[model samples]
Target: MSVSPEAIRSALLARREIALIDVRQEALFALGHPLFAAQIPLQRIALEAPWRIPRQNTPIVVYDDGEGLAEPALHQLRALGYTQADVLEGGLAGWKAAGYELFEDVNSYSKAFGELVEHRRHTPSLPAPDVLALIEEKADIAILDARRFDEYATMSIPGGRSVPGAELVLRAPVAAPDPDTTIIVNCAGRTRSIIGTQSLINAGLPNRIFALRNGTIGWTLAGQALETGRQESVEKGEGSGHDLARERARDVAYRAGVRRIDSADLKGLIADSDRTLYRFDVRQPADFAAGHPAGFRNAPGGQLVQETDHFAPVRGARIVLVDDLGSRADMTASWLAQLGWEVLVLADAFDGPLETGDDGAPPPRGPHGRYKRPYEGTDNREAAMQAYLDWEYGLVAQLERDGTHGFFVI
Candidate 1:
């Protein structure tokens, strides 16, 4: 069966559940695609589809930009028992011909939502020079690197400590205990910094907080130096501040419309086989590997927020997060809800020795056709980095014109 672009657009407009799959390599797919079109790449359909689109009868429309991969994808999906699979009539060309917007780059919607957060909430930030001056002056400041630990170790601001996005709420209190200390959050680029900085503000932190404006890209363009092989991490305290952190994060999540549910509620969600559901343990990998509730996959909350489209390509699926500390899940769920997913923090205080082993990392789809992001490497053209920042600044307007992303900043 073939579905029209108009029909796909209508489904999104009405908030109906649909999976818009783009069966092309990540490199080709990243050139441009519909805001909600997930790149499954033809070879990954069998590997990623069953987990990504869990509902066997979920309405799915696969497309390609004249690569002729969509029809084969439809066949593969049907063979795997996806009853409601169909091909997008006219493929990517058809969607464009229908006068719809195509977003560039991966994680487009989440990044756009980050831009919207800055636009609406006026999230505060400091330029690279000011931050550099603070470090040189030895000012009372705490620079928190909000990327993954390995990313922090690779290259980061001087004196910056690794505190990935979701950990900010739980660990910031310990990182900067004094109310007088200034706090700055930085990521390789903008989204996580904006979200991390704003997350603290939303959680009612007394310490002054700012995002490292434009993140490391901005720092590099400003002719500033970065510290490499810095293994410093934010101290996870001995339960002194967790209750307060939990209280604050819960307030933030409540403001962002994230729900807290018990084991009984989880059972209800699991029984609803008609709808797609994802269960995750949003904690540090080590903590998860130590012990975690059975049946929940490890998805470090920080990265999950950054890569939601890849992790949960079924856009409308419900997500349930469990963390030993409820605050982590609440903070994570808050961002997910704002990004337009139905999300809840699973709050069951389970008692027992839980599952432990290697967190089943998702099968790696090889990097054969991965899109090379401009901000990744140490040596990027200044113009490309600046252009990327410029593109992000205009995303709020683009989001308005597209009108499909139901994102709101809290």
Candidate 2:
């Protein structure tokens, strides 16, 4: 049976329990999707539905761009024990025809919530020019790229170390042991930067922590130089090879008792949730945009670990992560378990299965969008820069006030 857009809207309005999934590529989903519509592409429906919906009996509605994708997608869902699966009567086109609102943009709700966080929390940040000057002067400031190693390798602020998302929680303190040295976080854009910087401040690190006002994207547009080379890991073990990195990360995960789930286990998880379940494709944004499981949110693993509080918010919520390679998720879930989260790495859920460390192929770099930070533009925007800083400063206290973080920093 097909479900009408109004029916979906009414259910959401009433806060009724249902799982609404948009089976489109991340790029298309980013363009527009219904509020609360978690995206998982059609090709990945069978693997993701159970893990994300976590309630086989919950109403599962899948929609596509009025193309013929939904029917086959629904069939896949039913085959996976999503017995309540149905398609939107006319797909995305029908939702629009019903005059219902559609949300657009990446992390749309999270971005709005981030803005709200800025308003309520009064976070603080360093203006891009000031940060750039620090780099030029050979100052004591440490610039850490809070993106994947590959993304960092593609391009990064000169002298920046690839700390990644989860590693920040483990290594930030070690990066700047002195309270006086500045700690800066950057990604291609704002979300990860904000989340990464705040994670440290929230963890009660005594250092002066700040997110690059925008990120490398902002830096690039300002005509600043980005050095492209191998992603240099600051904290090295016996050796810097992939095997050593994987072993070190696995040790951490095992110490935290992070569990790995197979396809059938995931199917049962989909049968268990009474509340909303979020499955995140914790890979780089561009990788997520290419394709991912249906119902998966595009939260790069590192950022997901760094900003667990802001992203998930729901205490005791079950989260499943999908990665094109196992190491990133494994590394992330380890820290998440220590932070007191119930996280699982869904091995088979990912389409075009992730490379094991054994694959020996280097990680791929993604297209870095050109986004200029407000402070760097011609306006100078002193008020905006200061306001940005003020917002970040407050997150430390917010994390304290809401103490049931349910995060385990592995």
Candidate 3:
């Protein structure tokens, strides 16, 4: 069976639980695809289909750019028990012919949504040069890197401490104890930086907060130096500070309409076999490895928010985040809720000793089809970096035209 691009577009606009899968290699898929399409390369279908498209009866439409891979993928999916598998009538060419937009790069929708948030909220930020000058002047400023710790260690602004996204609220108070201390949050690029800065703003932090504009990319572009092998991090706080952070995060989540789920509610949700459920532990990987509730996958809160599409491919699915630290889960859930997810944070759910080891989806396929994001590595060309920033700036207009993203800022 085959599906038309118009049909797929209508389903997406209607917010139906249909999966538009790109059956090409990561490299090609990264080049262009329908905004919501998830890349599950033909070769990895058998390995990934069951886990990614959890419902055997999920309406799945596979496509490729006339690469002759879609039909094979459709067959493989059906053989693997996907009852509603079909191919795109005209493939990628057909979708484009139908005048639907094709988004470039992986996690396109999430990145686009982040851009939309920044555009709509006019999230405050400071240029890298100004930030550098502040550092040189030894201004009363605290730079918190919102990317993963390892990413921060790679190349970060000097004097910047690692405080991954969801950890910002939990750790920022300790990192900048003085309410007067200026807090600057940054990521490799704009998305996490925007989200991180806005998170603090949403949490009602007294400190003056801003995102390092364009993140490390702008810093590098401005001929500024970045520190490598940095070890500074915001350690977990104690007593009233931690409790205050937790309460603040929960309040933010509540405001965003995120639900609090107990073990009983979680069990009932799990029992609903018809719905796709994603249970993630939003703590750091090291913490997750040390101990996490069973049946939950480790997706650090920062990465989970940044890569929501990769983690939870199925739109309209329910997500329950597990975290021993209430602040992390609450903060993560708040962002997820704003991003149009039916998200819940488990409260005091884990009782016994927790399980260890990585339990998430298989490791991501290598960089074959992955776009070498300018914000990621140190060696990207200046043109590519600038071009990436330009693309992000235009995402709000694209989202408006797409008219299918259920995202809302705040």
> Which candidate tops lDDT?
1
Q: Quote each prediction's TM-score.
A: 0.97, 0.61, 0.96
260-333 per-residue lDDT for model 3 (tens digits):
97898989999987778889999898998888898888889989998887777777778999888699999999
* Per-residue error (Å), model 1, residue 298: 1.6
Per-candidate Cα lDDT values, in order, are 0.88, 0.64, 0.87
**Cα-based lDDT at residue 379, candidate 2:** 41
Q: Please, what are the lDDT tens digits per residue for candidate 2 over residues 1-410?
A: 99998887676545465566777766677567765576667766665555445556677788899767888888888888877889899889998787665655444444433444444445577767888899889888888888778768877778888887755655665667677898998876565676567656544567788888767656755667667875676662222333434455555556668787877887787776565566777766656667677656677777665445335533345778776545566666765665556778887876443422221112222333222333233343556555444544444354444232233232
The segments of candidate 3 whose C-alpha lies over 4 angstroms from its true place after superposition are none
| Cα RMSD of predicted structure 1 | 1.3
- Per-residue lDDT of model 1, residues 17-135, tens digit only: 88999999898887889999888888878888987787898999999999779889999999999999999999999999998898888888889999888988999999999999999
> Residue 410, candidate 2: how far off, in angstroms?
21
C-alpha RMSD between model 2 and the true structure: 9.6
Which of 2 and 3 is the better model by TM-score? 3
Ranking by TM-score: 1, 3, 2
Model 1 steric clash pairs:
none
lDDT of 2: 0.64
- Candidate 2 Cα errors over 4 Å, as ranges: 6-17, 44-55, 97-99, 236-317, 320-410
In model 1, which regions exceed 4 Å deviation? none
